[model samples]
Target: MGGNGKHRWKISFHRPSSSSSSSKMEANHHNHHKQQEEPPKDFLCPIYGALMADPVVVSSGQTFERLSVQLCRNLGFSPKLDDGSIPDFSAIIPNKAIKSAILHWCDSSGVVHPRVPDPATVEKLVRALMAEEEVYPSPPPFSSPQLRVSERELIRGVAENPPVTFSHAATELGPRVNHFYSSSSEESVVITADNPGTPLPFATRPLCYSSSSSSEITESETLASSIPNSAPASEEEDHLVRNLKSVDVVDQEEGVLSLRKLTRTREELRVLLCTARVLLALKPLISSRYAVVQTNAIASLVNLSLEKPNKVTIVRSGFVPYLIDVLKSGSIEAQEHVAGAIFSLALEDDNKMAIGVLGALPPLMHALVRSESERTRHDSALALYHLTLVQSNRAKLVKLNAVPTLLALAQTGSSASRVLLVLCNLAACPEGRSAMLDGNAVECLVGMLRRNELDSEATRENCVAALFALSHGSMRFRGLAREARAVEVLREIEERGSERAREKAKRMLQMMRGRDDGEDEEGDWEKALRSGGAGGVGRNLHGPNSTTF
Candidate 1:
């Protein structure tokens, strides 16, 4: 027994033939053939109504009573008998031993957990369990529906961190009092997270946060640091939601989602809500003032990335730091989700600096130090590319020691585009360009591209364009680009990108390979003139009216 006399009983499912089980059997056939084995026609327990391959296994007489209690409870009986005692499930045991044996063989106790049912079996089970005689009203009106809205709020707010006060907008919230737990607590409400995994004062009724996907705390933090006592919980949830933008992404269609159901696995709900939140937040339609609020709000979702659920649907949650930390927790799902999140984030710049701040680079770089996946290696480098775009961020990138790791990434097959971008951006900066040009990066890029290992056509173009970025604008990269097959790769890109990814790659390639043939091509004199303004780089990028980058 684990908790509350709950015994772990594996109910073997008997079927005419279960394909999943057959497949499993077929997979294990090699081992089975080597040994003498017969079909698993197991034993039956007449008392508890169970089947087993071995009679040595103990019969679960008490288990039936417990299960009956649970089923009766679910079926709207308090399972406390009409006499105010626990039901005597001995009510189910009056049959002769032979009759009991037959019942045991029938529906008494074999369950393939997580298995959905055949329509016939489902219909039969429903019909049997729901005979007209078993029909009951909703528990005799249950004391005027005594469960009030404030009590619900008290339950959830206390559950939020436990010991919740009445002031979390306690005025007549109704069932929506669960909003904070739903929206604010981002951890997927899976069984493990919502259960007694984290130490809270109350163990019988779940309270406080779930076991998070991040570093394991010796103890959970004080709730005061997390939820605010004074926030008008329900009002805040509705007011800010109207402004988010919607992009027509090619994903699962809407209306297929069942977000309203209460039992759809807590983490799944978390993932769905999180995806909804982020997909909306990214577009300009969202109010800028709510950016930080939304960002903090979604950070709570970080815990679900470690659940090993297919994060692909909710991948847009932009939980880079959370996922990265999850990977650090030594969870396989964490590593995969972190990989997925990094790959997803590099597709845009919205959360780049925040990702850099989330302490991703050090762990990512550490993983990349020896990883062989070109995909993983490439995404890691790509994330660094976005992180380096901000000047303040450049220091952290350097601190993650990504330059050397990025240089190594260029040597891998999948990293050509990322390598070119990183090298180009680095060269565009005074120190970064100096580091690449004066060192081994030039030869490394050339070697990587020429090896035929860099399969991505975009990488080929980026390599060429990076040569131009290195060679043209700054004297430092200009010297390095010429040394790194910049001319050859540029020609390749001009030919391929036109028929390939269109003008974006081609225009960039052309810009890097520009000569003094046109006014635009002659950027130096214009750039020098542009530098006379106070904004310098800022003006050169965005005009005088442009907000600070």
Candidate 2:
């Protein structure tokens, strides 16, 4: 059992047979005839129990049908092995050798095999499952009121061992809380209510309040009044809201934690990435007044957004503005969560500019400038790093005074690598490089190299690239690079760094000595001038912005 006693049952789905499977079977039958021998179990698909076609191997060293594994993934479940461990779909490799072996067996046996359903039909079934039309509720007040067998068993267990308050137990049961009935104009006054019984497992007596009207006392107030409390009306409402919100917060937290833990399991993470329940539930709660609730919700969204499928889901939900609002007014912890969520979503190439268009930079700059938490500062810079990857986003970020802020962070903050990457991106533009030079970024670059606080080759590569840009700007800049003992560092990098780094270092060294290394540096310098500026040369240099999640 996991959080809230909710067990994540594996989704059961049958694989669709494809034309490929059928053709292979038919081809085997048309071959040589001989006495049939039993096919090895390894040659059979674990799900369909048939001769394997397009077999694939997983990390667990077990092979299964490709279509079957894909079907299981589409069903939001992992292929469960006999040992009960579910392997991630990405870890599964196509086993062409096993497939060939199965083909040989089928040809030698000359036995007729059943025609499997077309692979296209199987794919359609998978798409339907992925769309979740039949599994989960589409709208509120689900038509199918009956629960799953597992859910019903859990509910019956609760009914048999009833809680002290039937209302509390009813609340505990995971039923959709529809406001439809409560919001209706119809008012049915109960004369008297029955006690706990067989059919109605538990009953509740309405709170004895004077009959004013539904307008005077809201449903939540009525619920609060039913509980034994001696506070004034205002206090009662607050108490009720706090209790309700607390309960909601707990449920949301459990769901968030479940998603978090599910990410550790490859197959479970795939399902979580595709499932919309957590995203839908958390989106509405980002505006929650409670800091803890908003933080947990944003944290969950951040985790989900790390996956490609979930990243699009989050961005499409129109959450960037909401997240920006949280950054504006949320607590430090909430701001950190919001920043992480933003960057995770921005990983998608399409979302890079959308985040900038939504005005995410202001709050991000705010966090970068004033946040007391180093982690918050780092996260803000990281988010800005991804957002600035696009040309338009880079302009927006620099226009918002992001360059100076990032430079300041690089100088004294713990986010040296994050700030360095963003600086690297901005350095590709003329105005960005000028801003770096004006912000004394060369000194910070030198200090970073000297201090070696962050032992990352990527960071050093970025620093060298920035210095190279500044060194080419003017004689004074070249003098500054030399004063920072850049020559020694460049020599070491030219000797010890990667091939690209060595090439860049050699150019920088030749430039410092008032000599042209060759036509290569001349073309590069002209290209940098024409293209605005240069980025880090090493492949691993300044890879995607660092993220805490």
Candidate 3:
């Protein structure tokens, strides 16, 4: 009976037509297969669970979407995985292997693939061009536009996108672009050596990415051929070429500052100086146009001026006038950069005369009196200080009514230290001494000393030096110093100061007391220095070693 029941169930399962049964079995098998299929895990980002077009790896040994990781970093959080584990962002690296695998899988599975370049091609080109033996088989010549396209592709692949990548490449490719645009001899030689008799791809044009500039190619070729490799150019030639060149000034400025920081090689210095000249020629930009370009150029020139040769070159290029113009007409930000540039340029003794003659003082005085920025005021004062080391500059400053302006700052501004240093420099001459005395500079310096509010050792030293200069030989000046309590300050400095400061202080004190080292032959001053009576000001020497103040 059980066998008969099993036979009946089997017959019920297969009682339909043969074609219908086969078709039903086939449909069931297809549905089962579809139900078992799933998307490939390797192509999915561990963080976003989406197919990754641009995959990057972090230090925790996990892969994530590039945008997801960057977003996490921007939000000030560690990159998180789908499992909620945080990965270190700073150690994030490009997962080229995974990226290539993802593209491959997309291509095989009929999914839309990202437009990233094959890294293998770029690596091959880099290797062949930079090979140890120069005998490798060269690839066929690509057009200038093709070369640009290839570089663009390389940068895009590295950056993982198109638009951001293009901007970044154009910005950071300054040195390479300069090489291709201005000196194509190397590229030309390589192309000719690879295939004899073929014209170089970069030889007949300014190697720009714009493929539609054929009309200008003839002019570019003519200019390239006419200019010699080693000839020195006149200023007019420089101006013409600079106008013709299409380099990005902001990028070039960045390169210039970087070169100055890394090395002081003459070649780099020459390039930097040349860049400064070009920027100086574009002076109108410093006033109101291209704020980024103007600020970067100013900063680059400031850093380059730290080197003596660069400073000399920039000064000779007539940059002082541009800086002065900016100080007069630019935005406050630009004025600050110009002030800093002027201060750096003032370090060169030879630059002081040029700066003074070029009308730097009026803008500087304006900045000192009216600018709300303390840094601007400080830098202007410092430049004035360095410039006043030249006697004629001091006279010019006096004529500009600098004494009263600086005295006001010293009495009530945040730039008191810089003002006092300027006063010290001006006090080096007879006219400056009279100016300080009339402007009551002694009282200001004395107030600073008594309150212990001097900003730095340099400020204090300059203050003491100014006092010494003001009161060294004249009885009336000595009385002024004495009444202003200069002796008390000098004693304090002598007891605990730098070696040079102490020596200067002691000399000034001895001079104020009307005694010479020759008269104090027994080292009585040593005994006085140890004594604390009236802060060492009441020490009496009336016999052979003394005269009176």
Candidate 4:
């Protein structure tokens, strides 16, 4: 071996360490388990997941939900959850990447929600929630579903998000929760408040003229029972007793009159509507025919929300169409309800689209114009914010020349949520932010700012951010802003923008002051929108119109 002045050698070893490999394998398995697990089911957007753990609600959508109820009624889907429910999301998701919003709720608690999947899809979720595997129960295809009445009603309630009443309130109650009523089955007994002693209209009068000792009937009994207990009286005493009994009879009549007044003060139309709503919620259990009756009854409530004392109930029923009419009608109450409904349906894409189609944007802006609360105006703006969630709907809104309204809302609307959603849509729309601005939206926004007395902190803040968004996403829109004197507005925006938005304000300042030399930011407005802003600011916009229910 040493002959060539070098030694040849080979080395070999057993397999690598099993413990190290096993530990790595275990770690991998743990990771795999984690991957398989679902994200903790949440009911709020990631932004407010911590603050609004129970649910985020608003009351500014009154105007948006009334007419849309018709659209929603036909939207024809199951209602296991709010629009945020992943609807057949296995393959297609409705852009959860934007907010990761979920409108999940236990209906037993009666929480109106937004952006939930349509009823058809929610049925699956309800079935799954109930731990029921789909059982294609069939004698063959096209057979009658031997569904129990309760099961059918249950499905109707869960899938369609229809009203329902429980046997003993299986559903729980919450601060924001409200219960529905069924009209047909509820016993509408008319109690006499004026007179407790007098016989009811349904009761009979006793015939005993004289019962020297028993003429005074102490206990309640049918007139028939009292007749049997009466004793025969002598002639002289009978006449004298008759006079005494007459006084008692007159007293009884007075008591009855007083009782009648106290009992059913009166069933006003509003109370009737409220009663109908409650009864309607009881659903098919009350009567098979009632389901059909309730639809009309509930639709009437939209006309009633603006009334005193009963308007509070509208907060409970931010349901579609009923409330949308009010929103579209341009009533202050409608705007409030629309805002509330927006929060209710914020988690739903269909709801947003439906409310939008119901002409919510216009009224929303009007509401913001005379808003009493900063939050109310913000919610009104948010209604518009919610409307643009659907891409096609947003496009339709653009075609309607709605950008001006939304821009106005953002500029003079919510300080915090000023451009939160409108911008998202403008960015999402086929119309680039620049295109939106070209439609005179920048002028409209700047106009809002110009009209302001500059007293409202929220309003000023909102205006600045809205301008920033206009210029931020689309160079064309930004240039248009400059033309509209939006640069001047930007100074105001700079004065009001959040700490995070200051750099943007500075950049706009440079651009507006004509300091940025040659870079063209307008050519690709769409790209700018895609980067951060969807396009411009999104906020609730209330309309000036008012419709009394």
Candidate 5:
């Protein structure tokens, strides 16, 4: 009976058969396939259609692969995903939580972790998608009937009525005379020479013709002739348009030169000549291999962009990419004009964001630091100053490591005043503050203040303001300021500097002294700046003469 009991216990504790173990392994394999076949949808990027190695959230609040977002931004393409939604690539934030979730899912599901996609392969995919988009453009979204009718009417009105016209004689001159009206007067008087029976049309004369005995006229005839034997503005513009669209480089050069001359001083002509057809014709010449054509084309764009309305119109017409391209690779002369055009366009509040979005920051930064031309550096600095007024652009510049370059320039007094202005704007944002602190901006700025090396009271004031802006919630600033002996500089500014500088200096001193005033918090400082307090950078950027291009 005892032996039987032991046998029963042994049987109860025996190991499983080989077939049973094999069946358990098969079950696990099946579960692995099930998980691989249906991973979480959010783990995949809409643009890449694969697991995202590094996911980020864009301004549109959608997650995508960071490389994919960067490619779209650089190419200036906004992709439509399978869900028919378009992503805004203006701003990006890392989706750390989602990234963690994706990695965890991969580990648990026995799926291999995703790796960063190859840049060349990703670029090829993006270009192919862009080609498809070009071939088959997306349809417009639905709108109310009333809104649609209003839009149609607005477009038709713009199409039917040109911004400029010419006198009747000028219009009649047509292609016969290449001359154009030099005056804004609309009246055209045709005088019949002394005889009424055989009427003689007013003779058309070239702009540079000299008066001779045969051509001498009476006072009344001279007045009538002063009406100008010229072609309509539209006809002249069309002639330039044709030249710009010509295959020959000579014709293109002539067109761009004429455009530059015509739009240089006449505000009305600048507004009129900035039409879509004229811009389209002028676009290709901006990238021409011939130096004359490219320089004149960029200069013409600068002249045309002088008008207020033309600023936004030029950007909307797609001239920004060409301008940015010139900034990168054009001749030094052309780069100067390109910088001028960018500065002119950035003067408009509406254009600041678009210019930054279409990849203008990096090249502008390059021109600011590396260009040998003084005007190019000046305008490039001013353009950056204006561009960084927007928060998104400030963030982008910080990411580009602009603080160190700016600080270096400031230390050397190379465009120090303008460079400090950009720093002030950057200091308005949190990322800029952190970067500035990391770059030892406090010591650099304090050194300037201590030595009185800045250019003017305004520059000195801006340096103080930047320090004050950086002082918000920054413990590192206190220690750095102490080490740089900033307290003595602040004391001097508080005594003899401008009113704005004195005020900012006093506040920074208060913060450095470890005053527990409620105003020391970051939010309070931001609110104070936004509410037009002493250290406000964004709202006070546009000075009385700041818009000069």
Candidate 6:
């Protein structure tokens, strides 16, 4: 009986006939293919080319994987997709709906759920895409004839040892006179290189003039003679670089001052002077105890950073930490220049994270609140506004208890417009929203709106936008809005505010009235928010007239 039972079990596991086996194999192959099917196009990130685990909507109203957006922003490379459209990553908001749909689809379709990719792997992919975009078709062969011997010799000389100073370059170039004008209110002076002639485009703030007569000069003659008139531009640059690297305080001061003047107004010179040699030389001088050397060195960096390409270069050279150090303890004038440099450097997408990571937020906040110079405060506010656009910086600011300080500034109406812009960015994140609500931001913003205390239409728009961001899915927002009488203020805004502000106010009122019933209203709110929030303010704030040298 035991043998018969074992035989029966073995028979149950035996293979079928070949024909039957082939049919079963075919069925299983079809099922396997079905299981391996691709996901819907909407579920995939344009850059990642995979189902998105954490989707987010960017400033352009397009959804992408959050990691992909971060990588692109960090790389400062906006890629063009297959459809030939470039993404704008200026701001991003979580797309929970899309993320949910993706996960549900994966479950229903028997596809494995997606996971957040390794950051190292994602960065590699982003860099590969960047490399593709940077590749351009080679230019056609040059049609011009070969150069003469003197021209070649001149080019070789420049390549070997460039000009030492702008004045020296002007002297070597020819008889044309160079006029140096101060951008400040101080009286401008035209230093004639050879003869009085047409004015060059270069201009800068006034430098400290030597008080002694030419006949009385004695100690600085060796330094003065170093920059000869016959040197080319490359040689002149080298000479100034040597002075910057010199041990003597006077040489360092003169080099930085000359560099500051050289880069101030000449856009071409700013690009040329932003080399590694010059930046490295300017590094130590940034922290010099001599106020003149420190201020001028930082000011020169600010000038170099005005060039778009040099922004990232300056940050990568490790200037941010030193800038923060000076911002904390330097003189008021030096802090003004440091703030400006920080602001200018933060304009580049690549430098934003690095700057914030190198510990710029606390000192920047301090400058925004405590600096005596209005320019310092203004620049600090703008720097904060730009820096907080990145999510990491926003989180860091919230951790530093920056929301309350910022709200205090807004309530007191000191730089209210700029301060509100920073608040608007912070309100986009969950941590920031909780912090602001805890800090009674709804009351403060509502009060500002009720009293018409905001500085401009754009400022009021940003204020409404902040409240709008705060109202998203927060149980605390409704009660807070009621306590602040936000409905009346929003109604007034809906009736009289600018188009963007009116739309946002209407949405906020809907949420308060429990009429924000579906995704349609939410979608409209996203549209309104996307069109006018920090992105719009950024355009106006960084416009042509916004910044000056």
Choose the strongest candidate by TM-score: 6
Rate residue 228 of model 6 by lDDT: 40
How high a TM-score does candidate 1 get? 0.36
lDDT measured at residue 430 in model 3 versus the true structure, 0 to 100: 74
**Cα lDDT of model 6 by residue, 94-204, tens digit:** 877688898888777666778886789677766776565562222223111112223234345545765443221111101212232233222222223432331211112
lDDT of 3 by residue, 1-549 (tens): 111111111101111233444587798985585444334666565434456667765533456667655544433333222332234444456777678887776565445664432345323422332242222222323211112233334434535632221222223212221111224321122222323432212111111211223333333234434444453346533543343222444433444333322222233433433543343333334442555556545644554554555554566544676678788877665676677677767766767765675568888988988976655665677677667768768888888878888877776776665576677667667788788888877777767777877665545555565665555334566667777887888788899854435766787688778774534522433333222111211122111111000
Off by over 4 Å in 4: 1-339, 347-380, 387-393, 407-435, 447-452, 485-502, 512-549
Candidates in order have lDDT scores of: 0.36, 0.54, 0.51, 0.37, 0.66, 0.67
Winner by TM-score between candidate 6 and candidate 1: 6
Candidate 1: what lDDT? Answer: 0.36
How many backbone collisions does model 2 have?
Answer: 5
Candidate 6 structure, TM-score to reference: 0.59
Each candidate structure's TM-score, on Cα atoms with residue i matched to residue i, is: 0.36, 0.47, 0.46, 0.36, 0.58, 0.59
Off by over 4 Å in 2: 1-281, 447-458, 469-485, 492-501, 514-549
Ranking by lDDT: 6, 5, 2, 3, 4, 1
Name the regions of candidate 3 deviating beyond 4 angstroms: 1-284, 516-549
lDDT of 2: 0.54
Kindly report which residue pairs in candidate 3 clash with one another: none
**Candidate 4 similarity to native, TM-score:** 0.36
